[model samples]
Target: MVLAAEESQNEEPGPAAPVTMFGPDFPFPYDDWLRHPAGLGTIPSRWHGTEVAVVGGGIAGMVAAYELLRLGLRPVLYEAEEIGGRMRSVPFAEHPDVLAEMGAMRFPLAATTLFHYIDTVGLRTRHFPNPLDPHTSSTVIDLEGERYRARTPDELPNVFAEVADAWDKTLQEGAALSTMTQAIAHRDVPTIKSIWNQLVPRLDDQSFYGFLAASPAFTSFRHREIFGQIGFGTGGWDTDFPNSVLEILRIVYTEADADQRLIVGGSNQLPRGIWSHEPADSAHWPAGTSLAGLHGGRPRGAVTELRRTPEGIAVTDADGTRRTYPCVVFTGQHRLLLSTVRCDQSLLPRPHWTALERTHYMSSSKLFVLTDRPFWLDTDPETGEQVMGMTLTDRLPRGVYVFDDGPDRPGLMCLSYTWNDDSQKIAALDPEERLEVLLSALEDIYPSVDIRSHVIAGPVVTTWENEPRFMGAFRANLPGHYRYQRRLFTHFMQRDLPAEQRGLFLAGDDISWTGGFAEGAVTTALNAVWGVVRHLGGACHPDNPGPGDRYDELAPLELPEG
Candidate 1:
């Protein structure tokens, strides 16, 4: 488990302010906006029941729809499959109590906006057993056919410490990490913009690997290789090497990878809870009003076509039913606009269409299994160490996370979680085949332990690339894609857009600066909500201004197109 470098030893400090995902780009205080006493803006009395088409019932869509309802608008939600989208949690057939998190499993506390909904929905969270996390009993690092076990970072080999030190030096010298992190923690907009705006044009074209290679501290290829194999915070980051360095900086600078937590039951509960929850302050509706009740217990079918008409944006469902609404929020994967959904060319400007076409998504796969008990805790009599521990390897099973509910409850194990090329390698295999492949790899590391014997329920598997609704797991911008991302992230503030492109707004993790995290989904949802409200001739309370109200002053810095 690779760790971030410690703060400067000489720094004067009481307890520092907690870090939140306030942004290196578009640093708006979304958490404060959400918590404002003046609600999330209001719609005029005349537009109280006006219908707004919100495509996709994922976290972003659900958030947009739920907030829309509170603002007195009727959001007509359309979902292709289920409500939770990528926050999917699958229950074991035989052992119904245990779940296999097929989508997002862990979340960082910096995602405050997401936590707001989680708290509102009455969901609980516990420290996730990340590699080398304090909550984890032990961790095993297996690379190049060599295995080593450690209970903490200090227990690892000297080479591990060397690689960690090199990473620290690289960040401090190349990216000014400490200074920028302090500015972000303090919410100093001027300082953040001054530092990030300078870095954007300079680093936007650099890949994560390129950034590391250029650093003086990482001149050694062996050091770079080790750093990639065991990455900072979560797991191996070699798969993310091809992505833009700015993407990596966004993650680390915000502490998005540190001190992560998992929803008590499953991540799916947040979206599902929002779907069924009836807000006490919901305007223009009865006391018991909820999104579930509003839609008659189920959302409309999948949207097949989207076109713009003089009246409004028209949405056609799979059932051949057509609905036109004055405003529409599209929260699905942007790639769907080009593939699954038949969208009219005139709906958005040609440049925006180009942005959607150029969007890149990362492929991911996970294999999960249920066991009769937390057998991993059993000590090895000879070695005096646990029989098995959370494992990270360079082999097919890139990362293995152990989840022990309790002594009495069934145990869950993410046998394998791989990204990019690693995921593609096993994409063709069946569930049993995937399980066998993972077991075969783990067998080498824990030769004395028979992992297969304790299995209670089957190994469930998912390759996000094969899922038709979601072509890939999530978007990860590559080098030189900054302009494209800028177009999508700022699409919601559409006053400058042509009249034809005004009503249709885009909001999703793909449309946010920090994609693949729930904070991005929720923040972009709030952006879309603000867009919808403003489009329908509504305004936020003076005390609680929306993102759009502060857009001109706080928008992302633009780079040279030439």
Candidate 2:
């Protein structure tokens, strides 16, 4: 669809803009991810006097918005960019295809809040890139390997059992270290180092890695070289010294299969539907701004300041637009909170704010290329075109991800990933040469895939590094620090303070989940809602079993005692 080049500066927003393609120049709503697809239009502000104001438009913001709506109250949701915030959607090589996420590629099933919203949207989801999908059955851990194996979900139970068998007896010996492990495993504000310091070396005289590898659950066995007979084969290093890194292993090895799956079609669908009722009632959303502020209109500038209010809270947008409310639950990065938060020149509320400053984050960069062919995907035997959704990860020397941007003509699209530490260092390499280096690495992992050339190449980055507001990845506990996830922030979220203080409350991944995750973000939102409800003279979920308690019925998962 070529544009009719006429007016150089047309006031009217039309096809002249064409909008950035999310995938292959498709005509889907590209501005606000919450407006994805044609099922719903913009929402209108029919009612007035919203009870709360939800800041940030990412996972936490969306979840908080839903909760506010469920409890017969209204909330004005604001975002600086797309509704998915970090989970932004991008266009692919040509026309009709778009990548659905930029930040947070995957999550675990333990996310109670994300699943709740999924069920509410009534959207269908499929297991993500499972070994179950024959199209992708050959799941290669490395790009050059090309050799795909089934997903590891089938091995979850065995992994857990093996880890358990080896250490369970030792842990249950009524020893001081065993008791300490059990304690660290249950708390919200603890870290691997802290736990290790208290529960292991300091107490148990063991290390994390020792505890995991010694367990029978994690070790993998293979065939003994015969095709006919079914048999388990493996090698082992018998040792008594505890490796001490069992906690980190549980994140992937024990929980991978248990992670929640993605929606079948597009992740945008869930947010789009939730923000505005598709096929039912669309939102009262301001144009261009999927969700906007009540008094300040759609947030059009930087949010420079944030503070508590008498009834809720007050915020100043980029344009210095300040408004007051009773409650403000942050749904974006904590940096946003830190940036807008007015800290006294003196010391902060110890261990909390200082700890936040110390929390780490990685830089993220991507290069989106529109190509006539998906250069990385190996040619299909039948179509002679590259396979769509081909994935290349750290396997690339430069570090990147490659997938079809869109389905039209099978144009190629390549995105490279780099941490904040290296984004500047790798700035000199041109896109093509960069692709070469990255693809060479892919070859080492999946030698069969070839990308001799391409249609387009460029870099795309999510500036989490400079955006001090976010601190780091959504909810990283960093290595050796997982406990701070819940403990440190929980105090901030509680609403038991005086009325003057209830004006400000905390919400997001930092407050609820162990790490920066959609689930935690949503859970924090739910708790925020509960706080607001209490403020509104409304009953708690235990007292009121309405929309607020939609997912309260699901039984919570109980982690094993360390």
Candidate 3:
């Protein structure tokens, strides 16, 4: 427990340029593309108001819709539930300002593309209270009937330091973390490709746990276990142990898990903001045009069926309304195609179907409760420490984060955030039952404190696996699934595919190389936007080429079929 490591504070700063989610795969500069003065591209006047069906109102769908609107096309969005999708923020009925973020609670500074939209929406962010984060007041690590507190990694015990050193050594010697990090920071394409292409084939079949076991630095079983329980930067990665090692490399290389910040209101604000935002520079539309105005008020209901017709792709909503469009961009969970939506077999190639079927997803669950005040900040006379700090434990609660919105406002607490087996274990419990179980665990950790007394509003719980519209929290590719990931990610480049598959496109974090991050959702959405523009005979500005424009030189490496 408490195995997380902080980045070496002594390491000299390198280049002034920051590391971004540019990609070890595609390496497209989405942030720069968005920032370009030339703008995304335009279509012919004849197709200016052409309707395009966009399934799923999540960040991916919202980005696609917003960019398409800028390109002078109309995007008809459909969602089963709320607009934010997995970036859900549940507010108490009485205190609307007091919110509990059930998903996507933290966002890293490296997600520049996502930040583009955040800044566009004029939202503010503060440093998130992750374990050992500098902004955090304190951190408590409870492991197997033992408890320890620390404000910094150096304050932790010797074994924790050893575990941290072992992890750093493992990444350096085994994964070339520094080389990739430098390559990414400087946007050194050739160097990135050279290192990544070599590693793809060599490590695609390796699991995260397998990679750790094989590492000379992580030879100790105890060290590996501790590292798995509490990973560096973020929380425990044991749930990701079965995923491909390459997944882990992508995050560390770009520092995607480091220096995270939470949006002032909530992460949901980004999607919701885009929904109502009117782009001042958009084409074809007059000033004050917004996605909200286009749809009248809200998006259409969920899509129940999809089929190719003589005219184009046909979409049937849950309300029995049907519409046909020349192209459709699907940003929902890929597995939805096989279950919730009655999709035509010809919509995708057989190999792509296989990829969809083989895709793996990780289950996630969270429980949040509102507190009367920031009681956790109160000092305990006995220990002279904050009553409760950000916590990481081996107990059922797993991890607990405290969010204080000034002493005058109600505080929100995520009592438990668990993934995979841990998530499934408590999936059957009701919200109150879940709260009780978590409170019991916390009581054992802080016997002197009375957490139940501070509770003001609900214990909202979400088991993403149980949500019909979203089968899982996010995709996590298993060992040897690199081929599947490549196929799905590259589907946007449809020239090689048959005519039928060309019109239907995929865009989501699940379809991205680095799944589970908002950056992936934004980048893949841009890819789909490019794909849509191309499908309608539009082209990006020569000065500002899109991802597909550079597909030849910067495409992800392909493994041998055999």
Question: Against the unseen true structure, what C-alpha lDDT does each candidate score?
Answer: 0.91, 0.43, 0.90
- Model 2, 1-562: lDDT tens per residue? 1112222232433332211111100111112222224321111233323556677777767766765654344676667666666656555433435453455554544443366567766877654443223333322222224323232324323533343343444333312233233222232112222323233222232344344334343233221111001111110112111222332222322132243455544566666556654222323333332233333434334456665544346677766777777666666666444555553212124445655565544444555555555444555676453443334232333333343433455543434555444454444565566656655665565445444455443333344554445545544444334333333444333344445555344677655433435555655565566556555555532323322232222212222235
Candidate 3 stretches with Cα past 4 Å from truth are 1-14
TM-score, one value per model: 0.97, 0.61, 0.97
Model 3 clash pairs are none
Q: Is candidate 2 or candidate 3 better by lDDT?
A: 3
Give lDDT tens digits, candidate 3, residues 1-562.
1122233332654656789887899899999999999998888889988899999999999999999999999999999999999999888886888888988989999999999999999999999999999998999988888898988989988998999999888888777777778778878787788778778888899999998898888889988888888766877878889999999999988899899999998889999999999999988899999999999989999999999998999999989999999999999998999998999999999989999999998999999888999999999998899999999998999999999979988888999999999999899999889988889999999999999999988888999999988879999999999999999999999988878877998999999998899899989999999999898899999999999999999999988778
When 1 and 2 are scored with lDDT, the better candidate is 1
- Least lDDT summed over 10 consecutive residues: which range in candidate 2? 226-235
Question: What is the TM-score of candidate 3?
Answer: 0.97
> Which of the predicted structures, 1 or 2, would earn the higher TM-score when compared with the native?
1
In order of listing, the candidates' clash counts read: 0, 67, 0
